[model samples]
Target: MILAAGLGTRLLPLTKKIPKPLLPIIDKTLLQIAIETACKANPNIIVINASYLSGKITEFLGAHDFGVEIKVSVEPDILGTAGGIKAVEKWLSKDDFGVINSDIIATVDWDALKKIHKNSNATATLMLRDNPDPAIYGPLCLNEKGRVIRIVNTKNRDLSGAEPLLMFTGVSMLSPAIFERIPAGRAVEISSEIYSPMVKAGEPLYGYVTQAEWTDAGTMENYHKAVMARFATCKTSIGMTAKSLKYVTIRPPVHIDTGVYIRAGSTIGPNVAIHEGSVIGASVILKNCVVTPRSNVRSGAFLDGEVI
Candidate 1:
C-alpha cells in the first residue's frame, strides 16, 4: 500500500493546490517514484490511498500505465496511516504486503526485504537506517538480534541491552496479521497507534536495516536535499540538459522541465528545479528553490530558498 492520504501540513502552501503525492521530484511525481519502487517487488497489484485532492491523484494515476495493475482507494475523510491501510483490508488481506510513504525517496532492495521477511516469523519487518540524529527524527531501538524493541520511548522490553537507536524509513512489509491489529473505521497512525502498542506487548516486530539511498521529502529542506542528491548522482538527469542561452548563466544542478523557456540574462541554479510550462523572464535569478508547474517568474526578479 502506498500511503498518500496525508494533508502534508509540513509543506503548507505548496500542497495547498497540489497534493503531496503529486508533488514533483524532478521529472516525476512522488507517487510515481513510489509505485516504481514498489514494482521492483513484483506485487500482483498496487494500491494508493488518497484523500486531500483525491481527484487530482485519481487523474494523475489514469494518465499513466505503469505496467503493473494499480488501484486508488479514495478516502472521503483523511484516514491516518494505519486507518488508511485498514480501509483497504479486503484487497490486501490475502498475503503479506509492502507499504511505502509516497513522499519518501528510497531505493530499498525489495528482494532483500522480501527475503528476510519471508524467512522470519515477524508480524512486520520495517526498513530501518542508522539515525542521523535521534533528537530531530525520533528513534527506533533495535536489539543485536534485529528485533525492534522500542519506538521513541515506547519499549517492548528493557532497553538497557539494546543497540544504538535506528530510524524507521517508512517502508515495511507486513503480514495479514497487522490488519487484525489495526482498528476498524477511524484515523490512526500505524507507528504510535499500532506499532508502539504492539512493541509493548512483545509482538514479533523486526527491523531490516539497509544502507540504501533514502530521504523523506515531506519538508522543504529535505525536498531540496533530495533534489540536490539526485542531481549529484544522476549523470543523465533532467537537470543536466539545462543549457545556458545567450547571456543566460545556468549554474549546474538545475533541473528544467520541458516547455520551460528562460529568457537571456537569467541566472538559474546551483540548486534549483523549474517544472513544466514555467517562463523565466529576463534578468531573473533563482537559487535553492523549486518552481511549481506553469509558474511565471517575472522580469528582473530575484528569489532564493522560496518555492514559487
Candidate 2:
C-alpha cells in the first residue's frame, strides 16, 4: 500500500497545483518512483490511498499500465496513516502486505526483507537504517535481538534526541493482524498507536536494518537535497533543450526535462533545473534555482533558491 494522503504543506506553491506524490523527480513523479520500487517485491495488487487531488493521481496511474493490478483507495476525509490503512482493511486479507510512502525515494533489497520477514515470522518488519541526526527523525529503538522496543519523537518534532534508535524508512511489511489492533474510525499513526502498543504487549515486531538508497522528498529543502544527491550519483536526467536556436549553456549538475526551450546565449545550471514546459529567454542566468513546468523566465532574469 502507498500512503499518499498527506497535504504536503511544506512544499507549498509547487504543491498548490499538484499533490506531493505527483511532484516530479527527474523523469517521473515521486509516486511513480515509489511504485517502481515496490514493483521489485512484485505483489499481486498495489493499493494506493489518495485524498488531496485524487483525480490527477487516479488519471496518471490509469494512464500507465505497470503490468500489475493497481488499487487506489480514495479517502473522502484525509485519514492519518493508520486510519488510512484501516480504511482498506477488506482488501488486504492475504498474508502480509508491504507499505511504502508515496513521497519516499528509495531502492531496498526487497528479496532480503521478504526472506527475513518470512523466516522470522514477524507480525511486522520495519525497514530501518542507522539513525542519522536524531533531531530530524526520531529513533525506532530495538533490543539486542533486533526486536523493536520503542519509537520516540517524530520527523515533525524531535527535540529530544534519543539513542540506540534506528530510523524507520517509512517502509514495512505488516500482517493482517494489525487491522484488528486499530480502533475503527479513529485516525492514528502506526508509530504512536500500533508499534508502541505492540512493543508494550511483547508482540513479534522486528526491524530489518539495511543500507539502502533512500531519501524523504517531503519538503523543499529535502527535495532539493535529494535531487542534488541524484545528480551526484548520475541518476538524474537532463531533458532536451532547444538546440534549434542553440541559446543554452548548462553548467554541471542540472536536471531539465521536456518542453524546455532555452534561448540562445542563456546560461543555466551549476545547480539548477528547468522543469518541463519552462521557457528560458536570452541572457537569462539561472543558478541554484528551479524553473517549474509551464513557467516562462523572461529575458535577462537571474534567480537563485527561487522556484519560478
Candidate 3:
C-alpha cells in the first residue's frame, strides 16, 4: 500500500496548489517514483491511499497509463498511518505486501526485504538506515539477533549500547498477520500503535539495514534539496534549440522545456525549470525557481521562489 494522503502542512504555498506527491523533483512526481519502485517488486496490484485533493491524483492517474493495474483507496477523512493500513486490511490479507510513504525518496530493495522476512520467519521487516544523530527521529534499538528490542526516547538519543540506533526508512514488508495486531477504524501511528506493541509482545520485527540514500521531502528546504540532488544525478540535458539572445546568461543545470522563449539580457538558472510556453522578459533574473506553463515574467524582475 502506498500512503499518499498526508496534508503536507509544512510545505505551505507550494502544496496548497499541488499535492505534495504531485510536486516535481526534476520532471517526475514523488507518486511516480513510488509507483515505479513498487513495480520492481512485481506485485499483483498496486494500491494507493489518498485523501486531501484526491481529485488531482485521480486525474493524473487517468491521464497517464501505467502498465500495472492501479487501485486507489479514497479516505473520507485523513487517517493516520496505521488507520490507513487497517482500512485496506481486506485487500492486503490475501498475501504479504509492501507499504511505503509517498513523500520519501529511496531505492528500496523489495526482493531482498522479502527474502529476509521469509528466511527469518518475521511477521514484519522494517527497512532501516543509520543516522548520525538519531535524536531527530525515533530510534529503533535492536538486540544481537536483530529483533527490535525497544524504542528509545522519541528523539532517539542514548545510543551508547545500541550499535546503531537506526531510523525507519519508510519502507516495510508485512505479513497479513499484522492486521491481527492493528485495531480497525481509528487513527493510529505505526510507530507507536503497531510497532511498539509487536516489540513488547516479543513478535519478531526485523530490521534490514541499507546504506541507500533516503530523504523525506516533506518540508520546503528538503524539497528544494531533493530537486537539486535529482538534477545533479540526471544525465540527460534538456534539448533546447532556442538561441540565447545578446547579453543573455545561460547557466548550467537548467531544464528549459520546448517552445520556451527567453528575451535579451535574461539570466536564467544556476537552477531553474521553465515549463513549456513560458516567456521571460528582458533583464529578468530567475534563479532556483520554477516557471509554470504559459506564465509570463515581465522585465526587471528577480524571481527566486517558484513561479506559480
Which candidate would rank higher by lDDT, 1 or 2? 1
Q: What is the C-alpha lDDT profile of model 3 across 158-225, one tens digit per residue?
A: 76776667888789999999888787777778888889888889988998889888888887777777
Model 3, poorest ten-residue lDDT window?
Answer: 235-244
List clash counts for every candidate, in order: 0, 3, 0
Cα displacement (Å) at residue 203, model 2: 1.7
Better of 1 and 3 by TM-score: 1
- In candidate 2, position 275 carries an lDDT of 83
TM-score of each: 0.89, 0.89, 0.88
Of the two candidates 2 and 3, the one with more favorable TM-score, higher being better, is 2
| Model 3 Cα shift for residue 306 (angstroms) | 7.6
lDDT string, candidate 1, 133-206, tens digits: 76566688877677888787544333454458688999999999998889888888888998988889998899
- What is the alpha-carbon lDDT for the whole of candidate 2? 0.82
Question: lDDT scores for all predictions?
Answer: 0.85, 0.82, 0.82
